[model samples]
Target: MDDDSATGVAMTRNGSTGERQLEGDYLTNAQGEDVVAGIRMTKDLSELKKEMPDLYAEFERIALLLEKHYREMQDMEFTIEKGKLWMLQTRDGKRTAQAAVRIAVEMADEGLIDRQTAVRRVKPEHVDFFLHPQFDPAALAGGKLLARGLNVSPGGAVGQVAFDANMAEAWAKNEGKAVIMVRPETKPDDVHGMLAAEGILTSRGGRTSHAALVARQFGKPAVVGASAITIDLTNREMTIGERTIHEGEWISIDGTAGVVYEGQLATMVPDIKDPWLIKLLDWADSFRTLGVWANADYPRDARRAVEYGAQGIGLCRSEHMFFETDRLPYFQKMIMADYPVERREALAALLPFQREDFAGLFRVMDGRPVIIRLIDPPLHEFLPDLVELVAELADLKIQLKHAPDMAAIDALLSDIRQKEQLRKRALSLREANPMLGLRGVRLGIYIPELTSMQVRAIFEAACMVVKEGIDVHPEVMIPLTSHVNELIRQRTVLEGEARTVMAEQGVTIGYKFGTMIELPRAALTADRIAEHAEFFSFGTNDLTQTTFGISRDDAEAGFLIEYMEGGILPANPFATLDRDGVGQLIDMAVRKGRASKPDLECGICGEHGGDPQSIALCHQLGLTYVSCSPFRVPIARLAAAHAALQETGRPHDE
Candidate 1:
């Protein structure tokens, strides 16, 4: 054995997928980072046993001793000096969510730690990582790998390449194309493109780089510091391994493996429904007092959340139901209707859609409390893009001028008129800032009938489910409430409608009414709002926006990245809770709201709800539940458990 000797490390088992032995290549004359950096070619680690049998045996003995001493899995880095093995370092190993849970439980079974301690050992973020899809091993093996980099985030993505942020954004948004943004390194200016792109590739940056941190927060696949690839920003191209790919060229990136492929490779969705994971969550449940719900809008998502062990539905956004192609026309008609009768007609048509959507959600939830939020976004989202419509209208007018057939000209002229009218209406609907404009309760208050339709749909759906003898706990949640009267006005309409529906159906179904405490005003005045509201579900996405006066969509796309990377902002307030500003508001609201109504339920159903740090904060703030995306339920559950364990100090062994 020598100082420059090739070193090999093997995990006796696949720490990720529970496969057989997982071993890596042996790198000579290089440090550990060199091997992980994928900077040079290497040989198999198993070859070391044959090359140095006596040394390998001693190394094996030391590895076992270290693992036993640590009482946990160890990542051992060692060097051999002239036939003698010297253990350089040993620490708790980095394992995937599956591996972490499996190892922890097995260690507990072996009496190394208690089951509660086992639950505390695994991080919440790892659960989120486990839920992401992985590249198909067979497909990856067959594909031409262009380069390897630091896997900043974990997931797989395939898309046409874009050299810069603008190109990525334009390609994705304007052209309706998926893009993989490639850069020498990303800056705050590239945030917009980063958001639009399916994945990101950088020639330089480490795991904790701005690109990496942002990508992980957004759950986008990203590879950073692939120095093997040379990017030409001006040419909108990148060269890797003697091959050059231009803009729009197809490429696949596996952030988990840190490999970039020449073309789209197949992928397999990893099912986090492993029995070991379920057992891990069950153990988490025993330790945590906080509830874990999901922000599911569809029946499929609701079912998936239940499978993932969600306690209830926190924010079932009703606007998502309108985005379906079949339902968009009716919704657009409602948005563009000139008169109340016309609007009512459109709302009537949309009634069946809402009813069916809610019924399906309730049926899948099977009496799990479902918080149905009324439409929240501005109407323009439901309408055709005004700019695109205007462009189309211009093209049609030119076609009309050149038409040969009289009938064709008439039809073209009619289409032009229709599009022009819609475009005008859409333009009129546009606001300087839609996020602060006619949306949520403002929209509902302006058009009470619109809110009434959603309320009617909810109660009607609940009754339909009730007829099947299934208990239905439907909570009507009004979004974007800024004042107590706002909640009061909506509650009056909602309750009156609910009572009417119950009377009509000849069945009385109990339902609670609530408001989303999204604006700073709402939280500050929660005591007053709670008087009329049955519960408060904090919509932190909007709450963060309103509190900081930064739009969620714009903040990430603009200066927030710089603010974060430059250490100006401590963290992305959108991803992690702003404990000072937003947290204070939440604390005020929770304290006053609960005081106003003793049993007033409180929860958070925002992106931060799933975030491990945010979940811990929510638990500390006395939130009853934390809800996130369907895939994030396990993460939230684990985070809640971690928070509870920390408070109680019951599992301190880890």
Candidate 2:
């Protein structure tokens, strides 16, 4: 064969046309000249088709035949050897989420596959990626790359960098600027900043870190564990190599790609108005046996969940309701109160706000089961940082020492006294390990009033919404119940407050009381706990932490990433379910709980609920549902269908 005559051909079927199309064809040497630097210039596909029409036709025929055999789009590579067309390789073509959707729909339309098979072909992540904004290919190519990190959440974000949570909140809220929260690692206290920011970036932490979890919950773009980036909190800047990104500097991040770039990059939001996605999800709903629910706290989230086809609100975290600017002060007052009367007064002030919050969610959910987990975090989380309070007090003392007048001295002394008291209180409440300390059921039991207050608020809200002609199914879940007695105690408080509210409103409302199976002991003794509880929502976030004896936030930001990368661990157990350890616990709990009450309703309301692998396990274990963030409802819906289809080996209709 002549060197110039040898040609390579690549072909694929156009999704819209189903016609064999030559993607590219190139000759080894167009001029038949000696190669310079062992490189060969090539002729284009048009030239190849013009010169060798029969050869091109033969390749096209072969491509179509391969595609037909595979029953999918075939990417074929071929070459001419000794004037004869030779096939090199052929396989299913890889495609983008956009292409995947278009191909699936077109293939179904072409009668190559049924609608159910089309739904099964596309993965949940593909659907999720289809919904998020992505960096424009042209703009992304032109942009200067800064660093790369774990793609904790899927989306694109453009904003000015903010070093801390307060700066992020101030910049976003006060100046109306879109801020990217740049933190070493985020704590629960930094949630306000995370909520305000357009996206979150952290120098440390893996995909299941606090930053990752909250970003997913809020549906914000996030890149965590960017080890290349060094955050200097004191200087309000992050350094990547020799490049320093100061606070208020423009930066864009591709959370899906996990790439950080300097300055703004244009992004294109996917046309979520695609009819194919709607059709695919409809098919998913038909096949799925496991219920898909949303971990929604606010009415807005609930509404979005409904729009995305969430069957119900699986986890309504009541603590998130108190984090708003208008409500935090009252909650803090309640936390800092020295006496029960003072605490009750503060709780009384917060009751109306709580009621309104729950009522709004209930009204949006429209009678779907809303499993509301009562206040779970430790009290110290609500208070001002002890370090910040101490610093302020030290500054105030310095001012008091140099007071120029009696009036000034008196005012300084008053401020000093208040700061001192707060510092003391914060110190007293601070725990060596807050996660294992006074949180969840312990906090509620320590101050039964807190549980009573939240339960009353829930009942009052349900009653209010019920009277407004809205159906309400409130499932009050007690968090972190290691002992059956704790559930027994909290259930009594829940029922009493519920009865009192129903009597006051002159209307009875139906509600279920339940406990979150977060601790090993709780899982071990699930039968006893189930005896008192009407439902069990597995809080796998803490359950994983407790089972592994690792703090999720600390571990993910530290050794957990190493564990995953070093091959000591298969995956981040926080992100995917630890099927052996945590899964065993869950399976045992479900079996034991069902043994006690055969009709016991069980589900998971953790970060894992949104994970496809975990959702599959939950399906295998016969859990009732999986509750993820509002944004993840569609993903869960599709994943649940996949789980069901995998089990049954056919669509629901078949």
Q: Residues 1-654, candidate 2: write the lDDT tens digits.
A: 575356554547553333445565466533223222236665566676677788778877887778777778876666676568878778887666766776776777777788778888988878888678888878998999999999989899999998888988998899999988888888777888988998988889887677886787567899999999988888888899999989899999988878899999999987655777887788788888999999988999899899988989889989988899999989888888999899999999999999899899999988699999999998888888999998999899889889999999999999888888878888999999888889888888899998898889888988888889999998999999999998888788779889998999998988889889999999999999999988999999999999999988777546665576567888888889999999999999999999999999999999999899999999999999999988788889899999988998854333
Among these predictions, the greatest TM-score belongs to 1
Clashing pairs in 2: none
TM-score of each: 0.85, 0.79
Q: Give the whole-model CA lDDT for all candidates, comma-separated.
A: 0.85, 0.85
Residue 224 in candidate 1 has what lDDT? 97
Instruction: Tell me the tens digit of each residue's lDDT in model 1 across 1-654.
Output: 344465545553456554434354666656666666777776666667787878777776776677667787777666655556677777777777678878877777777778888888888756766788777778978999899999888899999999888889999999999899988988878888999999999999987687897898788999999999998878878998789999889999999879899988888887686767777888889888999999999999999999888989999999999999998998888878899999999999999999999999999998689999998999888878888998898899889889999999989989988898898888888899888899999999999999999999999999989999888999999999998888788888878999999999988888899999989999889999999989999999889988898877766766777687778998889999999999999999999999999999999998998888999899999999999988888888898999998998854433
Query: What lDDT is reached at residue 296 by model 1?
Result: 92
lDDT value, candidate 2, whole model? 0.85
Off by over 4 Å in 1: 1-68, 75-96, 136-148, 158-162, 165-179, 188-196, 207-210, 233-252, 257-266, 392-417, 420-424, 652-654
